[model samples]
Target chain A: MIWLERLLAISAKEARQLARDRVTFGMIIGVPVLQMLLFGYAINFDVRDVDAAMLDQSRTSLSRQLVGDLQATQVLRVVREAGSERELRELMQRGNARVGIVIAPDLERRLFEGNRPAVQLLVDGSQPALEKIAQGLGSMPLLKRAGTSATGVRRFEIRTEYNPARRTAVQIVPALIGTILTMTMVIFTSGASVRERERGNLELLITTPVTRGQLLAGKLLPYVIIGLIQTTLILGVGRVLFGVPMAGSFVDLYLGALVFIAASLSLGLFISTIALTQFQAFQMAFVTMLPSILLSGFMFPFEGMPAFAQAIAQVLPLTHCNEIIRGITLRGATLADMHVPLLKLVIFLVLMFSLAVTRFRKRLD
Target chain B: MTVAISARGLTRRFGAVTAVDGIDLDVPRAQIYGFLGPNGSGKSTTIRMLCGLLVPSGGTVNVLGHEVPREVETVRRKIGYMTQRFSLWDDLTVTENLDFMCRIYGLDGATRRARMKDRIRSYDLASHANQRAGTLSGGERQRLALAAATLQEPQLLLLDEPTSAVDPQNRRDCWENLFALVAAGTTILVSTHYMDEAERCHRLAILDHGRIAAEGEPKQLARDIDATVIEIECADLTAVRRVLVTVPAIRSVAQLGNRLHVLMHRDSADPERELRASLAGQCADARVERVGATLEDVFVAATQLRRPDVERAA
Candidate 1:
């Protein structure tokens, strides 16, 4: 009878508290809608209608036909036709065209004589995603020529490297590392702190002989352990299912994660210091999450952005974090190569920790 | 006796608002000092500053043998503070929460475990040791918070409105625990709104608008009010209250269930004798009984006296 009464009492209290929070209830339902609409409208992996400029050194009928066939697929458009290579190179540099197709003057004779033809495709290497797209689109002409040569003489040979499968998951999983950590740290730590203050436990804690630093460490230590566990879980799944290789030392990865967790925990502490209510902390967490997820190279590639946008993205800890993770995992980058990003993370940790400690109220205000 | 807490012109300012105004206070060791005030009267603010959670803008606070905001960590280690709210893990069991506190305080091994077990048993919470704190009742949660704060042996215990949400029975239990702590040579400064609880303190400070309006023993403050309560029982007691309201000698008239208690400013007026003659013809069956004043009457008188001064200051 006692056990039954306890169970009923606990469930009843839980239900009552859950029912009282209309906003959190709404968010649980609304968040999926928001994510669906955002992903559905804005996220697309398939490249289409990329601009191109032509520099036809051989103004031959064959060259014109090849250009026309490439344009017909709509992956490349001839935005400009330059008379010289210098002009073509300038056009590419000016961002007018993503791809520059140059055909040699002897293109028609070389192809007719069953000689392997050469077409130089000048792609902007800086824009990796668009460069990949342009390269994928540029391969179509060569494939068609290979088919046309019945005597086993191909006009051109195309080679694709680095993400040949063009799988979006490869690019997304590395970025997801930052997103998952930020989400976990922000939600759990801030929520815990705010709830304590809201429920009057903060007062009890303050009055204790425990220093503010000790209290902060105590409050944050559990969340850090939880954050690391979540990181391991995410990385584990990525490895088992997606075959994400551990290129760098696992020690290095964990160290990087420790820095990230420290930075994120400091941010959470700072937010808790400023916020009076649990609802306000939730709002602040969301406000911080949007920028971290969107601008931190998690959902978008930082290399494709302009210099100013890159500078803005640099301020986010996730930007450096993604670079560190991806470079180490994919490129097998050593500590020397990962030093700059690691340095940035260390600096972020220092700044966040210092600010949180300085502003934290040790006494009741 | 050495002072456990000593503050001189202590003040705390939050931007434009002064939460704790300039005030001087001293709490000797092993004494139960009660800070009695309504909500937003700076009791919590004063407690925080004394505990080194906040730095006073313009005052020196020496609590438990160290200056505040400088030796905060040392002082904090010697003080146990229980805030106005329950702050423990809702998902963790009682034993787990206590164990976590021990770890945070850097306590370990058999000592931490044995002491925690003893605390649970002493608090009558052994039956629910495995139960989550969130699943406990309000009174039980208070007990948990109390137990967590006291696990470490601190010289001073700062309780901020500890019994605000507790039931009357639990509030009584909390007071008993506090008194036990005092008996064990721990100085206590507890903030509370309940007068009955305040009356139990060694001495009480009545805080109003970030300043102490009065500070003395409950009986002493009541004596300072110099008011005697006269209980009047008459036919249609409503008529007696109405008559007393118009009389200048009668400071206030309140209904305590059926009988009317008339508060008189001076005994020279002899409210009982005067009221008896006035109501003799209207109701010959009227009886007047004089009674001792209570802390509630003192609180009322103190607040009433300060209103005009507060208006002028405003």
Candidate 2:
């Protein structure tokens, strides 16, 4: 009973201290909302409106139909008209077009003559995503129709599953929940202990009847509440503002989120133990944030990264969290479908908190 | 009297530097026991060890019938510790800070409210109750700290340099509050650098280089020192000090206000005549007389044991 009371007392004190610090309180809420909104707009994977220049040498009805088909796809917008292939090359070089299409002079004549009409497509391969979409979108329809007309050999169709509209906001907003949670929870948890130690309030606490485990729980309880608020704000903004839907179990998503929050908060606690000053702890938290951004596959696809990078990502709690969130919001995955990610998150939480507790020495020495 | 805090050969070392060397303590219950020393004298270190905030590299410490470092948590529950720096939450208001401490000490419900109200009135912080602790004056902050420290109603209170930052009148008020605590049967083990503050303690231990050089009642420690203190009033105090230092019988010379306090060897039968002869023979006009020793003299004597000249005098 006394242990429970001690925990409650410490939790109450921590809650009051957090409420009194208005600036930190504002940041705890504001940072997640702003980050969600910013990522919703900035992370567009759809990659539309590729500027293209055309060189129609045949000038026939058939060539006109081919160019119309490319424009209908909406992936490539034909922006400029070039008289010759040389002009199209110049347009591609002068930054006027991301892609160029050239039709042979005898394209209709050859097609009616039972011979193949050769068409050339040029693309700027600087950005890999745009290159694949541009090439596939700009030529696929035209090639399929022309090839079917000429021969009956190859036949296949492309179908997009999950997030069929390929909305960038949909993809980004769900993942932003994990990224934003990681950033806020790690910073707030690490900063709380370090700030107390730096400001000398820790001396008063250490001298009390409070044990180390009680102190850890008390210091982290208010942050768990703050983390929940941040999660709700990000999810609300993502759903209302960006139209990001949650297709899976809310229970599953929040369970994963709870584990992720624990891992990150304890990670912050671990950093605070090593960092003598709050500023140093802040820097360490930021350094951990970097890995969440790049290695956690939040900005990139997990399957697309190399094996070594995936191995690195496997250790980061954010990687598992991002996967869990995306699986729930995008795929409508159940707890059974995401047992690996869910279990990994639990493991991360247990390991991180154990290490943090070990590192957090009760004595000042 | 029951011993509230006692230690045997308590020691604490940081790398190559030993902050608190082998030392022992015996503090009686319900009295103000002071630890007087200069900065780095291990006063704070010893108190921290007693409070169980630090683990002694070596020692046997028992506080309020609890063995420390093993039963430290129990020791912590029965003692209230106040550090030199403002350890309470600065962002919290006076009332909020006291309330927080009350909760931490497991004070609850109406009892907690009553204790807070009593502290707020006695510490003279009734008007400043809602104001932030950081915005309070030094004296107000000190009062608020004391209020928080005593909120638990612990049997022993450990205060580290509690009056170092406050003004003279506030210091006196703090001592008055300490005396009030004593009257209520609360044992206080306080550390201070001020001689006047040390003199106020019922019993004090003078520390130097992490060792206890002397320990007794303030007056008794002053009266029973190994040397006689002589006062010389003169125009040229610098010359008087310099001339009195050359005398073989004079152990140490210190200037206080308009008079030069010269300490003579304990065996010297007539310290006043000896000082008068030394000043006149050295062509300095001065009137000398043996005066009763102050705690300051006892402190100087205890600390001077570590000095080379004072060692040579022995």
- Please tell me which predicted candidate would have the highest lDDT against the true structure: 2
lDDT of each: 0.75, 0.84
TM-score of each: 0.75, 0.93
Cα displacement (angstroms), candidate 2, residue A24, comes to 1.9
Q: What is the lDDT of candidate 2?
A: 0.84
lDDT tens readout by residue for model 1, B1-314: 47899999999898999888998998878999999988888998898888777778998999887988888878877887787767776766798778766654545567788879888987879989989888999888888888888888778888888887789999999889888888989899999989999999998899988888888988898778757778888768877766676666666778888788777766455667887877775667878888878888877666655775467569
Backbone clashes in model 2: 0
* Winning model by TM-score: 2
- What would the TM-score be for candidate 2 when compared with the true structure? 0.93
Runs in model 2 with CA error above 4 Å?
Answer: A55-61, A80-94, A102-117, A143-154, B267-269, B281-284, B309-314
Please state the CAPRI-style docking class of candidate 2: medium
Per-residue lDDT tens digits for candidate 2, residues B1-314, read 49999899999998999999999899999999999999999998899888877899998999999899899888887888899998898888999888878777776679999999999999999999999999999999999999999988999999999987899999999999999999999999999989888988999999999999999999899879878988888887777766765688766777789987877777877777766776785545787878888888888877874485465768
Q: TM-score of candidate 1 restricted to chain B? A: 0.91
- Model 2 residue A144 CA deviation (Å) reads 5.5
lDDT of 1 by residue, A1-365 (tens): 33333233333333333344576445433433344334433554666677889999988776887888788877788889998999999998999988999998887555556556557788888875787676566445453543345333345775544445555555666556666777667765677677777776566555544445555655566556655666676676566655656767777777777778877887887888888887898899889888777787776666778888788778888888888877766667766688998899889888876777787775565
Q: What DockQ would candidate 1 receive versus the native complex? A: 0.25
